[model samples]
Target: MTVRRPIQRFYTEPAPMNKLGKPHLQVVRSISVGQAPNIPDTDGVNEMLAKAGPSATLKDVARGILDRLVERPELEVQVEEILFLKDCLGASLEWLCSLAASDGAACFKRPLLWSGWCSRCDCEAKDYLMIYTKQVNANSCPGTPGSRSRTPSVAFSRPPSWESLDANILEDFDKWDFDSFQLSEATKGSPLHFAGWKALGGFLGEEPSDVFLEMERTSRFLEAVEDMYARQDTVLYHNNVHAADVTQCVHALLLQFGFAAYFDQLSILALLLGAIVHDMGHDGRTNSYHANVCDDIALTYNDISVLENMHISKTFKLMHSDPSTNILEGFKLEHRNRLRKEMVEVVLGTDMSSHFGNVADFKTLIEKLGSDPAEWHHEPKAMSALRVMVLHAMDISNPAKVLPLSDKWSDLLRQEFFLQGDEEKRLGLPISPLCDRETVRFASSQVGFFTIIVQPTFTLMAELQHRVKDVLLTHLQTNTEAWEARKRKEQLGLEISQALPLLKIRPLESTELTDLAVFPDTGACLFSPSRGGSTRDVPCDSQSHGQPRVPAVQRNVEDVEGSDDETALAALAALACCASVEAQVAKGFHKNRPAAPAEAFALFY
Candidate 1:
């Protein structure tokens, strides 16, 4: 061998190798004793961390070292070390650490580290000399030497938190709706004095001072409204909050896309105020309740839209209870009646079982508007029609939400309805279809209900308005599929181990069904999958009905006694007719009436 000259290793002028072969493997040395140990390789990053201390995690150490080096120009580390620092301090590292830890600590404390660096020069520099290298210049000198000149205007700019910014859109107005705001002592003197008054502020429309004062005076009216909503048993499903949402939606419709000009300030005020006060006197009973027990409200307005008419009247009664609570404070008598009528029409339009002739009529007006844009503004027909449709749509719009938000509302309504269903059971009343306490999965029922009532109504509206169809369709399909999948899972009766990955389903809630429709307060649901989609009243089969079955409530009302009184009366009449005809045939006196006049008189008597 040609005496390979002991392959000498090069060193920078300042660094000194150990004259005694090499330093001991375990010996501690000051950082200043050598050229920072050749700026540490990627492996050296981990080794450096281990050497630094036992308490620091790989992430903590790596990020700490790089951040220190980056901030201080005097400090330097190899590109490999920088890359190791980035790997150790990345979101993946935090996520992994989070998954391993019993409590998520790393994710909560996300630390920043360098992400970009060069590798070829870093490896070459580390091998050539036992010294670390900072970023190289074009000519390979360390730090700022032999590199492109830094421009006078060059500056580092902070990057935005893109993920955080994107998440804000969903949360912007979630908690700002009518369902959230309630009156407290702090809000007593504001323009939101009544139950959900802040949500009603838009209804004031160009009359801010009047609205504020009206709110102040009518603060006490909340007691009655709350009492109506918070009844002990039976589902008084429609409450003041729901009422407020309708009013708010109408206000938005009027303000955002002002309807026919005829519905001036007076029309807007009437529509909004009526929407709030419409469902006031609901007794948690159905048509029977309207026709029987709470008949005063029905009789007051005749049999037409009985329950809705009652609620409208009760709302007025609350206002008349106290002079201060009266909303017609400054209005003329004629103006007050006109406002009252407008309010009545809007309120009565929300009855699910009530006639939708008004809705049909309103649609006609809208169609007419489509034909003549010039005649659309300020037309009495269009104003009335638009007002009714808007209120109706809002009452049924909860199901038209994106799943996350829609599911939330659904859950809340479900809880409320279940509580009501429990009360109905206690009171010996029939449980409504959607309100059945034993409903295992509400999601499927929701899908069916959506198919029947909610979707069709919205589809019709979307067809006419030509706005929000995409959002509406997306919501419809999502909810439908979600509910259908849930039902299928329940029907299959499979546990988690048996559950197919594709069949994962969400549990049902009371709110989900109500979100689809006003949960029928009574137990007589018109739709059931078990009955092959028929509205027929039949016995519920727990086994065939899937896991959670709707429990039947015993009706307190009278039942029809089949063929008792009417059947007996009809039989007696038939017997008499048969006997008379037989007597005529047996005597053979068909044409001898002249001779037997006295006998015929006796038979007649």
Candidate 2:
């Protein structure tokens, strides 16, 4: 049986609803002459979305299908549902991309679902779709001819392998754009184990009594925390994956900024642990939910930083529960107390109410450091303050990520917000800002958030940390401008793709097309690779405004069957942190490369 992959949505009839109530969403156009437009130039997609239904539900179905396929690809059953959902997902994405692609007067509502759909779907360890997330703002996908055939400057191939991902990702430990979702999938929904180990490894290994024993001890603590996040009560956004993302990001920031140069090992451990367990007992709803409803946790802490206090207290209680899990057991009373105090400050800084105050305090501290660098160069006395501020930044650092990742986080956050919004509506409470599914303009809100919160805070980081200025702050600027452009184009009803120029993926200059991650619209791969290897040191494509020359990556013959069972699971475990965006550049540039191997999802009947 020949199964044609439905890359575009064809309309004639509304699709049939499956058991879950979400419509199959599209009819596959028979392979006729130009059956459907690459981007629909009408309001049909929006209409389809209204009737075809929630992309989030579709995302869940798609993921379930993929998970089953991943579990038993060898089964002879040909699931046409996979192809159907992929088409629906593609069509759903088209609606979003169409919002940017054409000049249309109708604005989309329920804006929260877009990012949730994309982030959750994209994070699939085995995604059925190949849409790269580059088009909204990064206008670097090659519209020019002969761009893919350029020669390589260096050799690079694929992101760190997903086969041994956790162990593999540590090699790229300092990269800021870690994909905790990928790692979560690899770790079987428990990313904290790998991320925590990576973040806390330095401290745990420093003059350890027994290195293996210390490793085991840290694992116990991390395991307990991961279990907490992965409790029966599921948290869509503030789960283990988010914890891992924050933890790895904190670890990366510390390394990139060289905080270890000033802060002691204990300070570093405390900070890392703070990131790991900061939201240990999060019940999905925000502190406001706990407070408004007068929940036990809210009452226990008198409704002041209720969630933050619970996180810290619960973490400590869990640590003290078993000797194996108590990482600071060997430390003296004073040292342990100091660590606990510092951790409390760090986790408390994450309270959303304290966000602006923390930023203001950090700004003041930055000024102080600037005014008298000599005094602080030797003292470093405000270590706890600095630690708290840094955790706060990392906790809200989703906007600091590159396009693909930043959007993924936005998707997760908004889903949580919308869920909260639904509860508020049911209970007759005011919906939180950016949480409402009906009235919120997500793109505009993101622009405002970037302008008001993300830019200034990261600007402070740029001033304080030189590497952030060179690497991180650059991404912040690019991401901010992208969101701003999205808002502008959306308001004007102009084609977003046309407003931006076609540029190149600069980070691919040192890698190969083996890193190609295909996008449905725009060049989605973070970038095209340069040569064959040596991509580890390469920064993301956003680091440079200058487009690099694209190169062709040719492979004669190599194994691509993809690992399964224990080996694959172990690798997937570590993928929580790193999945190179550069791999999505296949169709954008280097189109002449050999057909992708089966392992990379090059399907055949």
Candidate 3:
């Protein structure tokens, strides 16, 4: 397996960048937003003070649209389109991330000014960004992977349709079986706002009854998160839908099992908000990828829980700098601090490096609590522990979902994994586990994931909340069996392909063979009766979508009637009866495929 090899290889030392080491800039509440412009300082104002700089002017324009967004009871257009239009800052992926990280006070405030300075690092032009990353890795040069992409800054170029969301699909969002993907499609690529709205506004019910924060603030914050996860070339599994998924799961874990009843409004809101922003600005690479590559962000965070630390820091900074994104703006200072602290703690707890240990620690706590989730209410530490486990579990809980959702999520995750593997292959770094596409088996890999990570997480959930126990474990079992079945079929195809050359006898000259496909090189027939003209049901269809599914010739060649070597003839007939190595080739899997299930062995031997 190319699994451990690539993950183990190390590249050159991280180039030291003094600029990267600079302190993370904090926002100082700047010029009052939405105030009337000065009456023309030409009359009696000092020359230096009356310059009316770009920052002041840019803020004036960006803020011009802010009032409309904030005050309008609803938006007819997508928030991103309105926010990222030319009249506003016209932000790029990197600039948006930088704003969340350090440049917020300047970038968004004076986007044009910073544009000339950092336009090269646009995250939207990911091909260029990747090229620059490779050049840096190849040279071990004194530059950060992202900041020097030298690509043109792009407009947020809104993705998906800008039409209004389908209210019908969103009506079922509260259910455990709710599909975040469907929500994303319904919300025009901005489902987080609706999900976030429900988290704070609807879910809170009359908690702290008097205060009502506008959806605008919460939507802005959540939209920023969705924006950060959008990448040009990379497919992001931790995008807004995953964020919404975690938020929903956190709610179900808390409210369904009586944990929310114990926690106050603020604490519940803290956990929900944490789920919303936990993966903000995710670039789809794991922490180990960052640390190994010596990415600028990793260096800034000291290579320890680098992505987690960056997510919370940049995200909170986004909230701090923009009133539109700061949902906690009017709360009591102490309440804000408490919520922020808990949010940060829970987000940090999502890093996988500490996953098993955290799970073990939480398991120990569960043992102490003796299957009672209500006991967590009295134990503050236990409550905190529960919060950590819930988010971490839901964050990785796709496997515990129904077949299609799990399949869709797995496909997305593999896209991300292979993207990283592609980079690792280029940089000569060891490919991390499950990242290498050429060597990894899609179906079998998930079976191990189910065993190691997925099972334990839901087991803990079952221990904490019995209501969800059957659904969670049942989905897990179904998904596991489906993958196992797929794995077995794939193995049969592979083994048959391997044994083809041994059939040294002349190829069967048959009149009945209608549409049997043969390898040009091997002369082995690949005949899949099930795949005959139509696409199969998908939960990771082993057959590549590229394959022609139209019905081919159909005939079963069984034990060549009077064959002298009966066993050989029988093996050949069975081998010729089904799919083989071409299936793997069609799916773009090369080099090595996994071989585990023994059921395939019984067929030919």
Candidate 4:
């Protein structure tokens, strides 16, 4: 049977020299020529090209062509023509020279050609093409006598071995200082990339070559993640550092809890990858905020785990667009499909809305296992549940960390919330609770969150893993205590401010105390002048009489007594003594001076 191959029809026209003084071939129009029976599915190929757009550079076209050729090897001739045209258009020889230099022995090897449709434009408009020398042994290269081909420096040369990632290291995850393992020079300020690469490579037990390849791919992916996040309107709480923290936590959980045994290499890969990209492309806003405002992402996901869905979709889209960063490119079709499904579900589970549900599911799974580790170990459903639950736990595990780390994350989260609150206020929207800086009490909110959400979750996890119970519970207890102490201090300060008036009193000018009358109803002090011996009233309201009414001080004292705070009592006592001495001095002065007319009387200090 004669099968027709897919044809890409392109209407090419001569264009003026580009800025680089090179002849440019403008693609006027493009259309799909035809589909060949022998051709494989070209959707992935087309998608990659489309991402590059219609006005792609020669380098872009070359990459697209190579990607398509990897999937469909039957389109050689058409690809050759595209390459020839690219060369005629003054395509740089730098890439070819670099390849030749690197493959010193294979410089004279016969060039391999491949062709496919340019997925960006209509099938007829642009053809994908590339030409490369076949792989050859470096030892066979005819270089200068005695000259040697330099070997490329390998990242993760001393990656952690699977055997070393056992219980001890897993338990040390909380104590692990990720920055200490960073290759600052290689990662270019992205220590997390190196850390993730080491952890992933170690967990998979990959050989040096395989580990190096995967590391390169993962590094590229991490770079892409960094770039995507850099472009996002993200806050400090959901940035790259937080994502890396979560990823490390997830890795630790898998190893620490012995959950690594249940997951295959592919599953572990997906879990680690999911953790790294779970919060990608965050817009520094909550899902509720997005849904309430009808944001584009909310509408796209129909308000169903909007932020999570966006993160997963954006991550996958980025992976598909860039071959260098497509870490799953080597996976089999079924493995890749499973990876995508697992990654999506796990990442979505990171959303706080699903937290309770995940915890509930974990509990149910544990109940089903019923003290039998053997039964749970091989059960796929249980393992899957554990996988997601672990990720969920890690996502909210900031409070489960040691004091200093926990405090840092808490402050960052509060800052993000306050920023959102400011925006809401500006937009005339009702601010969300724990977001409004004017009203939200940070210590109180954290206390409630720990008591209500974090403590219970970690407690459940601890119950499942008796060995880790102390570690989890200890941190939770310390953090709870810290917040509680803060709450109490804040309350005490508030009471002290209210009680200040109790100690501020004015002394009566007359030595005779029998006429002293306190009017509780009117909060006034009645005094009789020594000269006329007539009673006169002074209001305690500071605004009205330039002096506080005596009744307000009594009220403040009553409040202080009701509080039953020893500190408050001591403060009140000291203030009362000061007030008594001032009054005595004033009375002595008034008695020493002759009594004046009532109209001329003045209140003493």
Estimate the TM-score of every prediction: 0.45, 0.53, 0.59, 0.56
Q: In model 1, which runs have C-alpha deviations exceeding 4 angstroms?
A: 1-196, 199-215, 218-228, 231-237, 256-262, 281-285, 288-304, 355-359, 371-374, 377-382, 412-431, 439-441, 470-473, 493-605
Q: Give the per-residue lDDT of model 1 (tens digit) for 1-605.
A: 68665222222222222223322122222222111112222333434444554244434444445555546647444543442332332222332222211101111222211111112222122112112222323232233211222212111111122112222221221222323222212222221123233233322211112222243333445445555653323432455445544555554444333332335556656665666666665555555444543457667767667877777777787778866566577667786888788888777777776425655665576566663333556676666666666677767776776676566657756776676566567767766556665763576667766787777676656655444466555677788788776665444232211222222122223432221111122111111111121112223445534322222113211121122222222222222222233444323322222222110000100
The C-alpha RMSD in Å for every predicted model, in order, reads 26.8, 33.6, 22.1, 21.6
How high a TM-score does candidate 2 get? 0.53
Give the worst 10-residue stretch by lDDT in candidate 3: 35-44
With candidate 1 superimposed using the best TM-score fit, by how many Å does residue 119's alpha carbon deviate from the native?
Answer: 55
lDDT by residue (144-198, candidate 2, tens digit) is 2111121111111112333355544544545677677777777666678778765
Tens-place lDDT digits, model 3, residues 1-605: 46454211212222222233433223222232221111111111112112433233333333333444345626543322221222122232232332221121222222121111112221112211112211112132222222222222222222244234454554455456778888776676677765665555332111121133333455566677667765324557867777877887776556445555445656667778888888888888898899899989989999999989988898888887887777776678887788888899899999988889998988898888877766567788888887787788878888888899889889999999999999999999999988998777777788888988888878887876676677888999999999886676555455456654532222222442334444332233433243222122212223534422222223332322222222322333433323333444323322233322111111211
**lDDT of prediction 3:** 0.55
lDDT of 2 at 149: 22
| Candidate number that wins on lDDT, 3 or 4 | 3
**Which model is ahead, 1 or 4, in terms of TM-score?**
4
Please report how far candidate 1 places residue 591 from its true position, in Å. Answer: 72
Model 4 scores a TM of 0.56
lDDT of 4 at 2: 95
Q: Which lDDT values do the candidates have, in the order given?
A: 0.43, 0.55, 0.55, 0.54
Q: How do all the candidates rank in terms of TM-score, highest first?
A: 3, 4, 2, 1
Off by over 4 Å in 3: 1-164, 203-214, 231-234, 256-258, 493-555, 558-605
